[model samples]
Target: MIPPAFDYHAPQTLEEALSLLDEYGDDAKILSGGHSLIPMMKLRLAQPEHIVDINALTELEYIREENGVIYIGGLTREVALEESDIIHARLPLVSEVLPLIADPQVRNLATIGGNLAHGDPGNDHPAVMLALGATIVAQGPEGKRSIHINDFFEDFYMTALEPEEILTEIQIPVPPQGSGGSYKKLERKVGDYAVAGVAAQVTVDGSGACTSAGLALTNVHYIPFKVTDGEDVLVGSKLDKEAIEKAAGIASEQCDPSNDLRGSVEYKRAMVLELTRRALRDAANQARG
Candidate 1:
């Protein structure tokens, strides 16, 4: 299948890209790494009248730390995140999960902004971003604004981004002392979307009581499911078997999986429970250490 004919514009600067978006409005689609948009275009699931290519906007391609937050450019590739020393040291969960997303070839061309902006429930970064309490920055004709991860994802293939807005960066706060995180995913095979995946981040006090916790699931709902009920279960206690089990149960209860080739609804729900438990345990252990 071939994509519909469209006008193409490669903008070298952010302002140039924004101007194109302003002109095209909803008729245009931003092309980042082209992993998601190109596929949808080819399948005719998306038929934009214009394609605004921002790959040449080098200003949006960086990874840096500022004021206790790690800022990743919208065009930053998954492979870059996987290999970033800053990410490995400050956000191990990102380094751990990047490899689990598709394969090396896909990661090489996939941008974190594209993955999140596409609003696919199967994408790995949304759940991890939720678990890390990240924020996204978007720029438009009006100006730049920030959207929290909790509010950014609205539905399947839907987000808070206006048609003319472009996501510019992702911001992740540095984890607190004694903080640790883990991502556990169950896929049909390597390089496949997760059947069920869980990302957990735990911060424990010196006495081992959880101070803050985040739990999120992927590929099991219309949006990346943030397990607030499950996170509440861990926040005031040690992540023991009983607490973990209860949290897992709560998380599993929130799942509404469809019967797909990867799994039956029941099977995916079960995997969610198991992965939640394992992720929580590993995160708790790391937090304690």
Candidate 2:
């Protein structure tokens, strides 16, 4: 499929990219890795008059740690996150599932910023970020600001980003000592989007009691959901079968499933319960260490 004709600009600096976005407004689309957007353009769902590519903007291509937060440059590729030694020790969830995203070639070209900004509920990172309590760091003509992952997705295929705004980084707080995290997804096939997925992160005390917990689900709703019962059940208690079952029930109740190629509401609902258990179990294994 051929995409519609558009003016292309590979901007070396953010300022140049922002200027182009300002000029084109809603008619302009920013290109990071081009995995998602280019495909949408080819399908004619997105018809931008101008394309501002920022792959050459080296300023926005790094992963750094400062203070208590780990800042992943918006332009950082998924492959780098999978291979990051720093992330392995700091956020093991990122290390664990980064490779599970699409395939190797796509990972090398897909950017974290693009994935988050595109706001696809089926994508892996949104729910993961929500579970990690991360923030989207963005820039606009008005200057820079941060938005919580909860508020980032406004609706289906919609985001909190303004017309002139550009996502610059994803900031996640480093977990304290004895923190463990895991992400589990069920795809029909290797490259298929998840039928349902879970991201679980927890902080444990010396006695093996959960001090804090975060749980997020994907492919169950228009936006990713943070499962309160699932998280609350683990905190202040040792994760067990009973706790997981109760939490999974709550998480399943929270989902709004629909019939699709994946399955029916009844099946997807079952997945919410089943996947939650696996995710919680995986998280518990890490917590035990």
Candidate 3:
């Protein structure tokens, strides 16, 4: 499959890229890793007249922690996240998700910014970010602004990013002492998208009571589904069998999974229930340490 003819612009700097986006507006598409856009173009699902490639924007390829937050440059590759010590130590949920995204070749070229900005529900990062309560930074002609993960995804294949803006960074608060996170996914095969996945992050007090919790679902709804009800059920609880079962039930009930190749609607919901239980239990155990 061949993408339609388009003028390609490899910008030497972010400013040049923004200028091109401002000039072209709706007619242009920003190309980051090209993993997502290229396939869409080839299938004729996307037909932008201009391609603004930002692969040369080296300034946007980094992973660092500042103050109480971990900042991941939007252009940082999945492979980098998979190997990042900072991610492993500070953001265990993200670390867990990186390896499960796809095969090594795809991860090598898939950028975090591209993955988030693309707004695909099947993309693992959205739900993980939701569970981590991360922030997304976008740059446009007016300058930079931050969007909370809660407000980032507006609809199916849609995000809060304006057409002229480029995602620059992802900001995640450092989990406090005694905090831990995990991701549990049900996939048909190694490279397949999750049939149903859950991300769980929990902070436990000395007594092993959950002080705070975040739960989110992937590949189950029109958008990344944050299981706030499940979180509510877990917080203040010891994450006992009863609490975990209750939260799992809430997640399975609240999610709106569609029937597809993965399984029937009932099966996906069942996976959500079981995966939610495992993820929360694992996260709580990690937090207890």
Q: Which candidate achieves the best lDDT against the true structure? A: 3
Tell how far residue 238 is off in model 2, in angstroms.
2.2
Alpha carbon lDDT of each predicted model? 0.93, 0.88, 0.94
Give one digit per residue, the lDDT tens place, for model 2 in 2-117.
99999998887888888888888898999999999999999999999989988998788788889989999999998888878888888988887687789999998999999899
Q: State, as a TM-score between 0 and 1, how close model 1 is to the true structure.
A: 0.99
Residue clash pairs of candidate 3: none
For model 1, how does the per-residue alpha-carbon lDDT over 35-144 read when each residue is reduced to its tens digit?
A: 88888889999999999999898788899998899999999999999889999999988888999999999989899999999999999999999999999999999999
Count of backbone clashes, every candidate in sequence? 0, 0, 0
Q: What is the TM-score of each candidate against the true structure?
A: 0.99, 0.96, 0.98
Q: Candidate 3 — what's its lDDT?
A: 0.94
Decoy 3 TM-score against native: 0.98
Model 3 bad stretches (over 4 Å) = none
lDDT of 3 by residue, 67-162 (tens): 999999999999999989998988989999988998999999899999999999999999999999999999999999999999999999999999
Q: After superposition, how far is residue 77 of candidate 2 from its true place, in Å?
A: 0.6
